[model samples]
Target: MATPGTAKRMWALDSPTFTVDKSLLLLGASGECTIPMPAFLIEHPKGLVLFDTGLVPAAATDPEGVYGPLAEHLGLSFLPEQTVDAQLEALGYKLSDIKYVIASHTHFDHTGGLYLFPDAQFYVGEGDMRFGFWPDPAGAGFFRQADIEPLRGRNVLEVPGVDHDVFGDGSVVILFTPGHTPGELSLLVRLPGRNFILTGDTVHLRDALTTIAPMPHDADTVQSLRSIRRLNLLRDSADATIWISHDPEDWAEFKHAPNCFE
Candidate 1:
């Protein structure tokens, strides 16, 4: 592995396929749509890092347990191999090797594999830790107690709503782009040549940002719109490619693990 500053290899891991109402992804859109959940592996010289964990292993055999009724509602699909452990094994790595696990939010899809990396230093946005713990009961359905239980007293870093340089080098950064959730965090990766921005539900589909429409699941639509504007500015200023994690187009454009972005 190269040093933090020199670390450049990154792999994108896809979870089992999921289908959702297109309108749920982008307001005003209709029809059923399929999307892939993605997790990223970055081999930094300082330590191996994983960004977001796809669905839990149980999603394959016991979706009701992992996702409750939402599993069927979202049409969640899972294959045994889509588990983080399986994906890491296929990539020649183990959960024990991961030094840091940066979570975008506490959504089941993103935090499913969190418990599997108990040894890794966990990180989530500032307000989200508490929000996940005691979210508004009215809409707390999204915050599963099971997902929040594993993070009880672990080594979790609550990243402030600002740009956090993971390795103290600008190579990899956590961007605070809250909207979809109280403290949703996006990612900025500066590679040797091209730069990229990982939009974690901040902008679910291209149309959401392009049309200035926020998804229905957002905690704050106004704030979501503002966040999208911020992302747009960041994209234009840095000339970074915005990779919407759930966008089918992006899933097709980016290669899965074994194939990576260097």
Candidate 2:
């Protein structure tokens, strides 16, 4: 059970803007190709939880090794100064202090910094781990072995169904939302005075959620829409604030590092 009156706090770690052409790739129809990617930090009574690990500094400097072809495809030229570790340190928290990490999915961008938090228990969807560790490197959803190698044999909480209560007391819950990837998931945190839902990539932008638009590269467009609807339902039920991982508008609206949710 969660501690009574537990205050939930969140911080924006990285806020990097990119062109839509570079982000959505084949999905941009209007040539309005620009978007922003933001990562979040959550503080709970149970422990410090990081929603998605943003791009590591190494990846930006050595794009060839970390980003591979994706960088070229997206036309990425620079990286953000605030890495996950640096941002956490700024808040007086170290990587080791983050006891748990919930990754919405294992895509390169989301999982790039997993190695940095080696001590944190990882929480991911069951199908995501399978998709990430597929034997075939050519597979559509395969993840780099280097990124996940350190997590081997560590504590991994795999959600089997569409939704799971992480702390029993409802302080934290992991929502399984497939579409962007086979097992993409979201996070919902119940705070002292508010609630929050971390939408991994279910709806990259607020526009997508309002219009219920599906991204072109999703595994299943229909499933993605269903997931979005589920998020809407949760939002209404909990009166929660929805945080889209890559929406620049949402990032701009939220307070940045050193300022937390609580």
Candidate 3:
């Protein structure tokens, strides 16, 4: 924690690279394409806040160890330096500095590094916990047992639909934007120059937001559309930027850690 009025600094962390079906990003699409798995480091005045954890480190050396066959199916790949610890170290920080972790959802890619931060307060949406405890088989192998196990009985804050104000400063707020998963969450971060809304799979790409194309893995198509519309309204109302989590185009426009948004 810095000071009460002190503004927070945000850094976009490096993530694993993977390819997925075009239709998986935008419905009714064909073929495959590359995407980035991003994590964020927020130097809040109260404490360090991390948004999502990207991929598991084991996936770097042994993809099969972390994700089983799904790792191969998605063509997941990464270097050891891209792991969360390495990314933090590259930014002149360490895993111990993180005070709170905001998980967008329980999907393998987003929650992979949670095991590394047991002492950090974990924030997640209420409904998503069920998926973590007993993942529905119909999710098409999106949620993983190994990833969810680490978060079982820790200091978990199950944020309800009302949304959560991370530091009570209205700077870094967790918005409950479901549909990608039962309790999918997004972020509303107020930086010095710009306000950013990190949409965690709430419409995998910007095109899906414009086209209102429901992703194939979306838990509820109608709810997904509503969430996208809600984000669009918020984006327009505040003139904020929406960063789609898995969109490579969005990822390309930012600087990975060691550089930051203040």
Candidate 4:
């Protein structure tokens, strides 16, 4: 394999959406905002990998049923065809073709398609699954029981709170930048022409990159800030583009599936 940044490698799955207050995406911001929830698929030379599954397929018709009160609050706009499995099939791949599932974290948005990959190897940060089950407190609503329940008998390979090179060639990496959730993670993909740091809720909007701020609900504000700073350093030093996954602005910037990153 000569390397594939030229083409035929990675693609962005179409996004579903959920509307929330601007304040939800960034600290001290306001107004209602609709954001994109994108998923990614990578056809690595060695194997197939997926990053961040969007909303539950059921959410398209029954958001309230799938997500409870939170769905009503967030206002979902998902299409049945926007699901991971459907998108993969559209692209001529199958559910079983995904050899690896790299979950940026177990937030409901990122874990929706995990059930499709029970036979594939799973990768997540150390505290993520644990946090998904225990959560922060008496009623932390982000962790959905349905999302975590399916992992019971699956193969999950947790990376101890640190950065990891997924393929050993430095093409894909898992950066441990927890804050939004206890084991929140971000992905770093080094395509031949460009590099991308997929910020998985580490900083929900591009504004956070400039302000260096953490959203109000993060598990550790201090750690969140530090992670932002680290990402900034990486952005500058490596000339990497930080793709804020939920940023609507970002959704417009990249081409959806059928179109690809590299």
Candidate 4 lDDT score at position 52: 83
Candidate 4 runs further than 4 Å off: 1-8
TM-scores for every candidate against the unseen true structure? 0.94, 0.87, 0.95, 0.94
Candidates arranged by lDDT, highest first: 3, 1, 4, 2
Tens digit of per-residue lDDT, candidate 4, span 1-262: 5542321367889878888998877898998888988888877787888988777777877888888888877887888888888899999998999988888888888888888888998888878888888888732777786986888978988989899888787788889998887788888887767788888889998899999989887888998999999999988865788899999888898787988777
Quickly count the clashes in candidate 1. 1
Ranking by TM-score: 3, 4, 1, 2
Off by over 4 Å in 1: 1-6
Q: Model 3, range 1-262, lDDT digits (tens) per residue?
A: 6422323788888888889888777888888889999899888778899999988888899888767788888888799999988898888877889899999999888888999998999999879978766766678478776886888789999998867878787788899988888889998888877788999888787788888877887888888999999999988865679998898888898776778888
Supply the global lDDT for candidate 3. Answer: 0.85
> lDDT for each of the candidates?
0.84, 0.74, 0.85, 0.83
lDDT of 1 by residue, 1-262 (tens): 5443535788888577779888877888998889888898887778888889878777788998767788888888788887888889998887799999989998777888899988899889989978888887655777776876898889999998787999887778899988888889998887765678898888888888788888877887888999899999999976789999999998888777878877
Highest lDDT, which number? Answer: 3
Error in Å for residue 4 of model 3:
12
Minimal lDDT window, size 10, model 2 = 20-29
Poorly placed runs, candidate 3 (over 4 Å): 1-7
TM-score, structure 1 vs. true: 0.94
